[model samples]
Structures are given as structure tokens and as C-alpha cells.
Target: MASANVVDNSDHSRFDLLVDDKPAGLVAYSRRGDNIELVHTEVDPAYEGHGYGSLLARSALDAARAEGLRVWPLCPFIQSFLKQHPEYLDLVPQTQVTRFKLA
Candidate 1:
């Protein structure tokens, strides 16, 4: 596994995904006063299929968990990635899971 750093770009209110010194992917989201929703997960086409997206998702979810934050994955890729990786399911809100059909 590559050393992917999941950094909080609080200034921009997004998550910056870095891998091997390159910006391989990103998970963008916003806080609506209370709940934080995952708006998007984009892996550079050149970095796709290398599990970097999954890595990015994992890191992002971990951050949410650490902050006691609930996630609403509006991005299809983030939703599907969470479905495939049920281990991280605990990080997402139970109600939100149903919306993603992960419940």
C-alpha cells in the first residue's frame, strides 16, 4: 500500500489526498452547521484502479470517526466504496446508510 496522506484542508473545507508526493485523489465535503456530508471523491484517472480511491475513502472516514462526525456520502463512488468496505460502515450515520442502500 502506498503512503497516502489524508490531510484536512480546513481552509477550503475539503480533504486533500496525497500519495507518494502526488495529489492522487481527493474527498471533498462540507459542514452544514452540524452534519458533514461527503460531496465527492475523485481519483485522478491516472491513479484509478490502484486502490488509491479506496485508500482515500478509508482515510476520510477515519477522520470523521475521530471527530465524532456523521457522514452523508452524496458521491456515488464514496457510497459504493463504503458499501464494499463494511468495516468502515461504523463511521457513517446509520440513517444515511439506508439512503445509500447500504443498510
Candidate 2:
């Protein structure tokens, strides 16, 4: 099986997951100063249930961690993912958690 690849298409404010070099899913976000607010996530219907959304979410979050940027997971999928994976909580500012309703 071909491994999927993830790329931040920042010009379009999204991160894409590619399978065989084709877009399989994307996680959209908006930049806010030194932070990013995850706005949405979508996987091509054809790729649904293939874990593309989760892959995209993980990649987007990993990128945020690598860049020393905080994430506000406004997207429900991201929020749910974070809820299940509390290890990523440190990448989100404690103060904004309440504001974003993440707490």
C-alpha cells in the first residue's frame, strides 16, 4: 500500500493528505497571530473510512507543534481527536481552552 503524505497548503489555509500524490483529505485552519484555529476537516467521500481525516488532523497538529504554534481546535473532529489524545493538550494554551470551549 502506498503511504499517505501530508502537506501544509498554507496559501489556501489548509493541510492536505495525499495518497498516491492525489489529495485524499484536508484540514482547514485560520492563522491568528502566533496561533492557528482549526476550522474544518474533510475527506473525499471516496477516501472516507480510510483514516485520511485522522491522518490530516495528526499532521496538522504535528506541524503546529513543530512550529511552536498553539492550536485552537475549533473543528469538531479536531476537538474530538484532542479529547481522546490529551497528550496534545500542551500545544493548546490553557487560558484559551475555556474561550474555545475546549475545556
Instruction: Encode model 2's per-residue lDDT on 1-103: one tens digit a residue.
Output: 8679999998999998889999888999999888999999999898888878888888999999999899988898998888777788889888766665665
Error of 2 at 8 (Å): 0.6
Tens digit of per-residue lDDT, candidate 1, span 14-65: 8887888788778889987546788988989987888888877888888888
Candidate 1 weakest ten by summed lDDT: 27-36
CA lDDT of each candidate? Answer: 0.82, 0.87
Give the local distance difference test score of model 1: 0.82
Q: Which one wins on TM-score?
A: 2
TM-score (all chains, Cα) for each model: 0.85, 0.90
